[model samples]
Target: MKKLNVTEIQEKPEGFVASVKEELNVELARTLKAGNRMLVDSDGLAFIYIIEDELDYYYVSFGKGTWPSLKKLLANQGSLDLELGNSLNIELTAIADELAFLTENIEGNSNYGEEMEKAVSDIFL
Candidate 1:
C-alpha cells in the first residue's frame, strides 16, 4: 500500500484520520513512541511509538490519562456507597470497555478509525 510521507503526517494532516492511517500505518508502526511521558507532555503530547516484532506486538494504547479516573475510583472504593459506587462503577466499566478496543497487532487496523481520528486530531492540533 502507498504510504504518506512523514512530513505530510507530521505537518498537514487535515483529511479523515482513517484515510491517513491507510496511508501511514507503516510509518506510524515504525515511528510512534511506546510509552507515556507525563513529564514531557507539559511541552506537548508525549507521542510514544512502538514497532512490532515476533512474539510481541500491539497497535493502539490507552495511557495513564485514559484510565486514571477509573484507577482513582477503584482505589477509593471503600469511601463510596452503592449509589456513588454504581456511578464510579459505570465509569470504570466504560474505561475498560474503551481500552478493550486495543488489538494485539495490526489485525485491528481496519477498525481503528475512532482512535486514529482522536490521535491524529491531537497530533495535528
Candidate 2:
C-alpha cells in the first residue's frame, strides 16, 4: 500500500487542480501538500492532511468553491459545509494505509519530549 502523493491525487478527474485555478484564481501546483487521504464521490474531490497532533486540515472542491486549511466549513469559509459536502459521503479514514503512514511519520518526527523538557526546565527559572 504505497502512500499517495499530492501529484497523483491531483491527476484524478475529481481533483480541483484546474478548478482551483478557475474558481479561486490561485495556482496550487507548487503549494499543495501531500495528502494523507483522498476521496472522490459524486459531490467532489476531498482530501486531508495531518498537520500535527490533534490538528487536521482539509480541502474540498466541487469544481467551484475551493479552499485549504479549513478549520470548519462556513458559508464564507469556503463554499460548503463539511457535514453537507462530500466529506460526509467520503470517509477519509477508509484509507487506512495512508492514514497509518501519515500519523506515524508526522507524529514520530514531533519534538514533544524535547519541547516538554525545555518547558519544564524553564518553569522553575
- lDDT (10s digit) by residue, model 2, range 1-125: 21222322122333212212222212322233334453332223333433111233435332212222221222122222122122222223323354234334334333434443333223311
Worst 10 residues of 2 by lDDT: 16-25
lDDT of each: 0.26, 0.28
Q: Which residue runs of candidate 1 sit more than 4 Å off their true CA positions? A: 1-91, 103-108, 114-125
Compare the candidates by lDDT and give the number of the best one: 2
RMSD of each: 18.3, 15.5
Candidate 1 colliding pairs:
32-48, 32-49, 33-48, 33-49, 34-48, 34-49
- Model 1 lowest lDDT segment of ten: 82-91
